[model samples]
Target: MTKEENLEKMRHSTSHVMAEAVQSLFTGVRFGIGPAIEDGFYYDFELARPLTPEDLPAIENKIREIVDADYPFIREEVDKEEARQLFADQPYKLELIDEFPDNRVTIYKQGSFADLCRGPHVASTSEIKAFKLTHIAGAYWRGDERSPMLQRIYGVAFDSEAELEGYLARQAEAMKRDHRKLGKELDIFSIHEEIGPGLVCWHPRGALIRQIIEDFWKAEHIKRGYDIVYTPHIAKLALWKTSGHWDFYRDYLYSPIEVEGQEYILRPMNCLGHILIYNSQLRSYRDLPLRYAELGTVYRYERTGVLHGMARVRGFTQDDAHIFCRPDQIEAEVAGVLKLAQLMMSTFGFNDYELLLSTRPERYVGSIQMWDEATDSLATVLEKLELPYDLDPGEGVFYGPKIDIKLRDALGHAWQGPTIQVDFNLPERFDVCYIGDDGAEHPVVMIHRTVLGSMERFVACLTEHYGGVFPVWLSPLQVVIIPIADRHVDYAQQIKNELEEEAIRSRVDERAERMSWKIREAQLQKIPYMLIVGDKEVESSNVSLRLRSGEDVGMRSLLQVKSLIKAVIEARAQTALEGESI
Candidate 1:
């Protein structure tokens, strides 16, 4: 067996042991599905009371006992009726058993515990070498909102203690770098329960950072010949039906609202609007490759259980664009998007990333020939650029095939960043066309893309990637002036004003706090620069410059400091914060 298969089997076996432990601990615990995930394993159970962190230790102890016993895992295949009899007391199991179409069913047993599962477990309970019960979460029985909610215990298992410890260390770092924690600490963004979950409210600092990013994004798109456009949030439901979204993507869409007898719903994507704009007028071949871009907000019905901080939200603004071009322009357009995605990633300090070429799904709308051509175009571009990518078969959007850019952050966690898709179906559905050289209207090839994916998620990524210490250009508050005493407050304010004039963001901390305390607070906020003004510096007409990285550049003239900061911001340099660089 391959190493991956062995690891999966071991983890699966560890989950079974955990289930056995839970069964022993609780009076009557009814289990839902338990499966091995990418990094670990999780088991869902319906218990009398919710499980807590304090209960994990007891469960772990029970698991240790089972492991020490070294009971062999025995596999049993029996008729459906026999399986029902075996798990008559477990309602969830009975429900699953009823769903099985065949009479033969697989069950595994170790010692006194048994579960309805297919075999592939370790030889014995003792094979689980290293494991840890990480945390607990609430999960629906089958991800249905109206279904019964169950408690899910998550854990990680490895072949060695060293591997387990390494994973735990990374988990700890991930907790520290979690965007939710850092966002709150840095006063950037927050989601309030009163405002409803998954909706972000950006504070001044966060809004400023978004403004900077959007400004930079607009400039880049203009340079690449993309026309910025705006579209409404809600559109007539029939429009989506025409675009094939209502039928294929209904699960993610919200129900339509009647406005004066007309049904309208929140737009789940920005592509259809762009397509409509393309069909708005007759176009010649000279206007081929018309790229329309929008930082448009769309709403989707993401289940509450899957709602995460910025990562999976109900509403987000996609840095979305659509290109209408002739068939021959597909390669060049795809290549341009790749280049833009690469530039965006590199500018944000993402040096490691993977590409994925996704093909058509079974329920896709386009013809087979069109699907193959679209998939081939994306593959050809990746190969022409000599870019390595994995094939994600049947993972493409219903409209077309795509190339996905998954960027790796500082902790080597991959985040979805960019996507370039070739679409031939949407233009057909909307009858988007341009006049050809033969003086006949022909179907236009459509390309959909996003360089940064979404502003909310990208900012979340930026916060975690930088550990909240954003580079000079991206930092919302580029500098803070800390006055030593009341006498120096005026000098600090003057410095802030001067920096602001240079288009550098700065604030004067005139609060009634000690200078050292203020500096520490500024450092905590991750401001790029902290300028200290004191009686000595008031005499000398200069200030002490300190970087958020904890490096101190000795007293320097305000002119010198402003010049360095302006130059850094102008160039959008990522590594100038460590005093030595200056």
Candidate 2:
């Protein structure tokens, strides 16, 4: 067999080995479809007993034992009736058999297990090695949530041990940077079961950071000629119908609420609202490139089981905007949006990003020429910016072609952000228009773009990216004044007041604990500076700086300390808070 055929057979055979091993270990574990994914394969099963983390090792051992026995994977093609009889006890396999052609069906037999499958498996089970079952989760049969919840045993098969180890190590590192753990540790945000899932309640510390980010975002948008706008959280259902969101995208949207018999749907997107604002006025050639921005909060329907901490949520605020530009300005507007996304993300210490440009999908509504033009425009912008990107064929939304940017965190996990999408359907449906210099009304080209994705998800990503070690500018408490003794309380308060007057977020820790304990608490809170003011500092009119890392930076004036912090904050510098870089 050719190398391509051999690799396919290898992965296919590994699935059988995994299934055989599971069946041997658990007497009544019914099988489901097991297919090879991009990096690995997974099998679904309906277990008589729910398997926990403890059951993994034994199942793995059984799989290895099966491989060691070197069972030959014999393939046979039989008529549909024979296949059905062979898999009589397995309903899921029998379902496949019923769907198969009446002419013939293939089955693979290994050891005591014979499964109804389409063959091209490896010759023997001994060829299966360098594989692992990475995770176990509950999945709905055939991805329909109403169907039976089956046990999904996810595993990875690699060509070598080194590759397997590398994948495992990356997963371990991702766990270390898991945002839920870091969010609590850093006191960023939380979702209480009592308050319900998919909703975030930001604590004071977290809200302060978000405000800082929003302030920066607003200032940048202003500088880039974007008009800030606000709209109602709930809009008339008639508006959604006009935008076509009610028809095509309503499944992912929240149900409408009736107020006095008028259906009002919670806005799932800011695009339609912004389009309404654009259509509120007749546009001329001079107003061809109007940009509107808003930190718009939106609601979408996400099932309870799929809701994650911050990353996936039912209600979230998006850093959303819409660009109403002429067809001739499409390329420049796309490039401008791309530049803005990079600038904002990089300030938050996200420098590496992967760009994906998705072209028209099979069921797209726009004409082929329009799709080609929009895609070519985006490609031109990418090329002009000298950015490397991948083309995702037939992945664009039904409305238009688009660009997606995925940012890499410190742990090397990619999070989706900064999407730019061209929309022909919305403008056509809304009948948005702009008049040219020649006095002819034309269809406006609307581009929907988002930077930082959503506030909740962005905060989660930032928490994990920095590992909770936020920069001085983003840190909730930039400075904490820790008095060595009760006698120094006056001096600490004085310094705190001075720092506060300078707009520095400084606080005085007045707890009756010992000096060492106060310092430790400040460090634990990840405060950037622990200003230790005591007799020496009072006498010298200077404060001894206990850097967050516990290093004594000798003595510096209160002014000098403020200057150091201001420099770091202004630069938005990212460094180990405890180390030489600070």
Candidate 3:
């Protein structure tokens, strides 16, 4: 078996053993679904009482004891009636059996436990070499809020001790770099119960960083022949119906709002608005490939339990753009978008990334011919650019085929960054057309793309990727001036003024705190540079610079420092002034 398959088997089997251990310890326990997750496995249980961490050790011991017995996993296929009779005492299992359409059912029995499951388990419990029970939580059955909440036990397993150790080390580092903790510590953003869950309120510093990012994004799009546009946050619900969003994507959409007796929707996507703009006027072939860009804010209904800090929020601003082009222009437009995505990701210091081409899913719009044509266009562009990519079958959106780019961060964890989708269904649904060379109206192909995905999630990723130590170009406050005493406050202000005149974002720490304390605070804030204007530096008309890394560069003239900072900003360097060439 492949390594991934083996790992899945090990994890699944470990979860079975854990369930058996839980049943052995707790009386009147009922089993729920248990499956292997990304790096681990979790099983849900309905017990008479809640579990505590103190109970984990005892349960772990029971699991080890069962593993020592090395009982073989025996699979049995029985009729639906027989399965239901066997699991009559287990209500959850009976419910699952009732849902099955066929008469045949599969069950696996090992040691003193039996579960209704599809079997691909390891040969025996002894195959689980290394395992650790991580934590416990309460999860709703089938992820539905109305269902009963079951106690969930999470654990991790690996084929070897060395693999387990490596995974644990990475987990520790990930905890230290957790974005939610860093976001609060750095005062970047916050979510309050009063404001409703999954809604972010960006603080002053966070807003400043977002403004800088948006400014850079707009400038780049303008330079690349995209016209910036703005659209409202709500529109008539009929517009969504026409775009096929209401029918296919209603789960993520909020309830309709009534205005003047008509139903309106909070915009869940920006593509429909961009398409409306294109349809505003009749177009010729010459006007084809019109690219419209917007940093549009959208709202979606996400379950509260799944809502994370900023990474998974209910409301966010998408760096969204759409292109309406003729059939022949499709390939070139896709190629151009690929180049733009590469440029944007590399600028953020994400050099290692993977591209995936997702094809049509089972429930999709448009004809098979159109789907094949659109899929071929995307494939042709990837080949033209000589970019390596993997095909994700049956993973595309209902409306189109897409190319998804996932960027690997410093911790080697991948985050979704960019996407390019060729949509034929929307054009057909809206009857979007342009005049062809033959003096006939023909449907125009549409492409939806995003570079940064969303501002909130991107900032979250950036915060964790750099551990809140942003580079000079992206830092909300580029420099902080520290005055040694009250006498030197005037000199510090003078330096701040000079830096501000050069359009640099600088702050003067004129608080009553000591100079050392101020320096430490600035360092903790992760400002790129701390400029100290003591008497000695004031006499020589210079400022002593200290980097966030604690590197001291002594006594540089104001002009020299300003020039260095400006050079770095202009080049969009990802590092500060360490004498490295831009």
Candidate with top lDDT is 3
Model 1 lDDT on a 0 to 1 scale: 0.88
* Lowest lDDT 10-residue stretch of candidate 1: 573-582
Question: Which pairs clash in the backbone of model 1?
Answer: none
Q: Candidate 2 — which residues are off by over 4 angstroms?
A: 1-16, 28-30, 33-41, 46-49, 67-134, 140-149, 155-173, 193-195, 408-414, 549-552, 576-582
Backbone Cα, N, C clashes tallied per candidate: 0, 0, 0
- Point out where model 1 deviates above 4 Å: 1-10, 26-39, 44-54, 70-130, 137-151, 158-166, 193-195, 254-261, 407-415, 578-582
lDDT values of the candidates?
0.88, 0.86, 0.89
- For model 1, residues 5-99, the per-residue Cα lDDT tens digits are 98998888888899999998898899898888776799999999989999999998999899999999999899999998999999999999999
- Give the local distance difference test score of model 2: 0.86
Q: With candidate 3 superimposed using the best TM-score fit, by how many Å does residue 250's alpha carbon deviate from the native? A: 3.9
| lDDT of candidate 3 over 464-501, digit per residue (tens) | 77778777888889999998888998998988888888
For all predicted structures, in order, the TM-scores are 0.86, 0.85, 0.85
Q: How many times do residue backbones clash in model 1?
A: 0
